[model samples]
Target: MAVQWHYPLMSNYPLESDTNNIAAYLYFFKVLHSRKEKVPDILDINDITTFTFFKSKSITHNHMSKWGLSDGMTAQLRENVPKYVQQINKS
Candidate 1:
């Protein structure tokens, strides 16, 4: 028998970047699924980094409006994370 566990942390603020937490969790799931192993009782995910929302003030209003109007930005991040993770694994 095989079991997969998912523990999602819900915070008011974004973790690192928008969709970053989801991307990271998916990455871990992918790794474990490939190995077909049960999730350990104790796992460390404390290394994840978080970025502050306040920094958004530095971004241009145009970009902010675009993100609000469409799913393009979100879709891009979701698509990029796996490729980025695979690239990291090669090194």
Candidate 2:
């Protein structure tokens, strides 16, 4: 029989930017995989307090909307944007 362990990834402020957040997630995922550890598919940043630097959630939502980032887009960005940027940078 085989046992599997689960590890949760937490972030203070997710999607603060397109680049840094994705970079950090990629680095963390690489480190964990190299060590034969489990990495969660979803990043846990659902804490309302950590959602934004602003005091108001409404303000944060406004900013996110203006930037054209929905929750789905932000989640997908972490997985897809970094790789594209790396490829562009390498060329």
Candidate 3:
């Protein structure tokens, strides 16, 4: 049997700015934790990053009143995780 898992953490907070999207993922965590007794294993907080949200085209659409992003800002974490993960897998 195959099991399906979803990594969609942005569904809760629609039209949220890139930096403001953390709460949405928090909502996902809350839901997953609600049934903590059933699923003993769940992804850890350090497992993923939500930076992809900023790269998305809908960045400015974070506001219904704003159809597009006029000004763009970028964020970079001090530690490069994905890069290291990829290199580790190449072995």
By lDDT, rank the candidates, best first. 2, 1, 3
Q: Model 2 residue 30 lDDT?
A: 46
Extract clashing residue pairs from model 2.
none
Clashing pairs for predicted structure model 3, backbone only: none
lDDT of 1 by residue, 59-80 (tens): 4435433444234433442345
Better of 2 and 3 by lDDT: 2
Error of 2 at 59 (Å): 13
In model 1, where do residues sit more than 4 Å from their true spots? 1-69
Candidate 2 — worst ten consecutive residues by lDDT sum?
Answer: 46-55
| TM-score of predicted structure 1 | 0.27
Candidate 1 CA-lDDT value: 0.35
Where model 2 places Cα greater than 4 Å from the true spot, the runs are: 1-68
TM-score of predicted model 2? Answer: 0.22
Q: RMSD in Å for candidate 3, one decimal?
A: 13.5
- How well is each residue in 1-91 modelled by candidate 3, as lDDT tens digits? 2212234432333434343233333333343343422111212222223534433555333331232222221112112324433543564
